[model samples]
Target: MGFSSRTFLVAPDDTLWRLSTSKFDRMLRDPASHSLPTFARQRARMASVVVELVASEPMRVMRTTYSVLAFDAEGRLDPSRFEEQQFALVESVVAPVIASSAEENNQPVVDATARFIAQGGRWTPSPALARAIDEAALEQRPCGRL
Candidate 1:
């Protein structure tokens, strides 16, 4: 089995513009930038910038998708194992992003993203994850509030 994921972080407002002009996205779109060494270095730099931005801003939105494949010892498709892996991915990968966004954004944006992995595979986030995000958002009160 193999796992893969990608994450996009952007401000809620002007999402389209931000994504279009983002350095990472621009690099991806440009064919000339596809050299292995150059791409690797640029990717590292972009990731560093994202980390810094997320750490500093609460309102930035993070969009992410992950995929995994699983099979039993007999080579039978294992939906149960795949689902378990999906939940594990959410807990380990998505939870930290939610926590960061809530700490900075001051509100929870409950937009459900449908995740499809390989053929005939689908994963939806758990309700508990949503609730935790909401709670985190609520913890950030107004400046003057008690």
Candidate 2:
């Protein structure tokens, strides 16, 4: 089990914007002019998507989805097996990541509920991961099945 983390720029409205480690470091050193899309939660629509985050991503997705739950080989919900090949999605609930400005690419990315991609090996939870799970559910990004 291992822990992975990425830096993000949080918006005033509590939206998390992706930030690269290198970029974050550079931003700390130099405040350059940059612009990001304004996330209008009210305007963003929801769509259901299958998230399958594996240690090795077979394809690239323009949008990212996060899932917090995983099922074991026996189809049992195992909190510890999220990092394994345990993956599934609820078709009824729609993920809350689709928006007007989110059409940058046509690729697919599966953060596997945003929780399954914790590590390449066994899945383990950290304080940050725990919080991320909660946020994923609230946003309906890819977990909790609504």
Candidate 3:
């Protein structure tokens, strides 16, 4: 498999970690290996996770951050899903696509970010979601984009 071009908006909290490890464990057991379906599932899962974080705001921030960071280390996202998909992964599946035989954890995130931005810059968080986070922050909850 090759790298997929995608970007995601994940919530920042513990739920993100839960989603990542769960999916990573599942992928490790997937005998199908590197196929489109596996990648698609991971991608969908990542989207689900991010959307959830986006919906919850401050309460889920830390988990969302960890999830994004972890996935940022290993999974590829499905860019088009940013504004379309609902119910994303509890965390995220961010990482690079690997061939069946490749084990190197050296994919450059800078390159990936560059590519994502080149494709369409960063995703603007939904205005409503941003507003909610701001309100939560004022209440000392402090939810920000992850």
Best by TM-score: 2
Each candidate: what lDDT? 0.32, 0.34, 0.31
Where does candidate 3 have its weakest 10-residue lDDT segment?
63-72
Model 3 scores a TM of 0.22
Model 2 off-target regions past 4 Å? 33-146
Quote each prediction's TM-score: 0.21, 0.25, 0.22
Global lDDT for candidate 1? Answer: 0.32
Task: List the candidates ranked by TM-score, beginning with the highest.
Answer: 2, 3, 1
Q: Per-residue lDDT tens digits of candidate 3, residues 113-139?
A: 324432332233455644443334333
Q: What tens digits encode model 2's per-residue C-alpha lDDT throughout 1-146?
A: 22234333333344544444454344334323222224222221121122233463322222333333332333233334332422323311223354222445664544445333332322333456435543452343433211
Which has the higher TM-score value, candidate number 1 or candidate number 3? 3
